[model samples]
Target chain A: MTQQPTAAMLAIGDELLSGRTKDKNIGYLADAMTLAAIELKEVRIVADDQEAIVEAVNALRARYTYVFTSGGIGGTHDDITADSVSAAFGLPCIYNDEAIKRLAENYARRGIEFNESRRRMARMPEGAALIDNPVSTAPGFVIGNVHVMAGVPQVFQAMLANVIPTLQGGVAIISEAIDCPFGEGDIGTELAAIQKAHPHTSIGSYPRFSDKGFNTQLVVRARERALVDAAAIDIRAMIAALQG
Target chain B: MTQQPTAAMLAIGDELLSGRTKDKNIGYLADAMTLAAIELKEVRIVADDQEAIVEAVNALRARYTYVFTSGGIGGTHDDITADSVSAAFGLPCIYNDEAIKRLAENYARRGIEFNESRRRMARMPEGAALIDNPVSTAPGFVIGNVHVMAGVPQVFQAMLANVIPTLQGGVAIISEAIDCPFGEGDIGTELAAIQKAHPHTSIGSYPRFSDKGFNTQLVVRARERALVDAAAIDIRAMIAALQG
Candidate 1:
């Protein structure tokens, strides 16, 4: 069996840290990465400070197979992701001719002025590949393993679509869930044993309380479908025995 | 002005990393910390791995004034927060008699068995203080500067209420927002000047696209209300001038 590709996400913006903006990008990227057979192992949210961005980018890019950063790449003063990313890799960030042409054409077609701030969006790290943005003309860029994307959900999603197809994928993880009408305590010992038996699979017990009273959802996940199914069956039988 | 008390948050759960659960705890804690005159500096989301939890807890606790961790404090096999936190601090994790009594009473009152898994919630690092969980019977614990709370939204919020009042707060940050019907490029230069003028304040420009065309929300935040208002006035004037 091949090893699964691991990824980390960095959500950059003062808006997120200050609670002014609730981040939607992390969950979106998490699901997308999973579907692409890339395991998203860690996620970090940092403010718009350049030092913070550089530090997080360097750390995550080194630790994971891919590091995706969202936000701080727009046409504003706080949009420093491109520059910070360049700093992390010791690369020079300059305005790319292709990005400039794309932005200028989009602005000209809309009859909007291609002002300095708008032109700032054309800047990319040296030797970086541009990630296409279908929603907006401003392009995201990939430097080394770090993919810098816009903070806007529409643009980020679009850019992700462009990037995911270019990467190598591993075996997709299969998951099975069983809703057990019992507290975690009633099924934990048995659940642990099942987990022990299926060492390759991951068994998670999530407890929820609603009008129906306490309930637990046991999720079994593994790269192999047979392992997931086997573990799930054992979990179901254990829950049934505990209920009785 | 007094240095603002800074905090970091660690959201622990495989459900979150797997995108099975969209995290609501980070935003809630961000807003709560802001209101309490604390600045939330960073947020990390990690899976149900003990090593990940320990590393993040230790790193965040060392960097920020306070480290708040949510999730993994429940009665399940994946609930390894207490053990991980103890390991981070190099403290012995043991069952607290007080916590055990509380759980036993809550379970007995509800006619539920205090099984071994449920009893697991009573374990805490030696010399840690218990944080009240108003919504659930399982209590959270605080060891040193790290405050560990439940992963469930209701229990996490309830524990936050119990924890916030006990902390020392700094100068409250005041924020003002202005909605301008212009693209970020139209106002970026003037916004930069305004930000420079108010060195103590933080000005963030967020762009949006809707049927009404491009728009930007300029948020000005500072420890002093006068500085925030001043920055907002300059930003509003710049937008009005640009529109003219």
Candidate 2:
């Protein structure tokens, strides 16, 4: 069996760190990566500072198969992802003629001037490939295994669509969720034994407490469908026994 | 001026990384910390992995004044946060009699068995201080500067209330926002000048595109209210000039 490709996500913006903006990109990327059969192992949210962005990009890209960064790729003064990504790789960030042309055409269609600030979106790290943004004209870029994307949800999602097809995917992970109306304490020992018996599958027990009362959701995940099914069956039987 | 008390947040759970759960704790903590005059510097989301949890805990605790971790403190087999935190500090993780007493009493009142799995919630690192969980009976703990809390939103928020008051805070950061009906490219240069003129303040321009039209919200934040207001005035003037 081939190893699944691992990925790490970096969410960059002061808005996120300051709680001025709630991040929507991480969950979107997580779901997309799961469907693409990529294992998103770690996610980090950092501010707009260039040093922080460079440090996070270098660390994540080294540790994972692919590193995806969202935000700090706009035309504003704080949009420094391209510069930081370039610094991480020791590459010169320069304006690409193709990006410039695309931006100019996009602005012209909207009857707006492609001014210097908007023109800033044309900049890319040397040797970087541009990721298309269907929602907006400003293009994201890929330097090595790291893909830099816009912070805007629409642009980020569109850019991801352009990038996902270009990557290699492994076996898709299969998951099964069982709602068990038992507390974690009631099922902890039996759940551990079930987890031990099915070493191939990863079982997660999430306890939910509401006015309706305490309930637990046992999520079983594995690369093999048969293994997930087997583990889930045992979990169901255990829950049934506890209730009986 | 005293340095602002900085914090880092670690959101631990496979559910978050797998997109099965959307994290609410990070944003909640971020806003609470901001209001309390604490700076939230970084946030990380990692799966239920021991090594990863230990590494993140060690790194954040070393870098920031306070480290807050949410999740993985439940009674399930996958709840390994206490063990990982103990390993990070090289401290022995043992069941605390006080915590056990509290859990037993709470369970007894509810007519629930304080079984081994539920008993697991009483385990903490040696010499750790307990943080009260007002919502749930399971108490979180503080070992050194790291405050470990539950993954459940209600429990996490309640634990945060207990933890926030215990920390020393610095000067409260004041922020002002101005909504500009202009694209980022149109306001980029002027915004950069405004940011440079107010060196003590951090200016962030967030662009929004919708059916209403392209707009930008310029957020100016600083430890001093005067400086933030000053920056916001300049930004508002720039927007008015552009519109005129």
How displaced is residue A223 in candidate 1, in Å?
1.6
RMSD of 1: 12.1
Q: What does candidate 2's lDDT look like per residue over B91-172, in tens digits? A: 9999988899989988887688788999999998999989986456689999999999999886787677667658887855
Interface RMSD for candidate 2 relative to the native interface: 5.3
Q: How do the residues A121-154 of candidate 1 rate in per-residue lDDT, one tens digit apiece? A: 9998999988999898899999889998999998
Query: What ranges in model 2 sit over 4 Å off?
Result: B171-244
Q: Which stretches of candidate 1 lie over 4 Å from their true place?
A: B171-244
DockQ of candidate 1?
A: 0.30
DockQ of each: 0.30, 0.35
Candidate 1 is graded, for docking, as: acceptable
Give Cα distance to truth, residue A128, candidate 2, Å. 0.8
Question: Across residues B1-244, which tens digit of lDDT does each residue of candidate 1 receive?
Answer: 7787999999999899888888998988887777668889999999888899999998999999999999888877789999999999999999988899999988887687888988999999999989976456678998999999988776677677668768777855566768888876677788889889988776765554344655656667677789888888888788778878
- In angstroms, the error of model 2 at B113 is 2.0
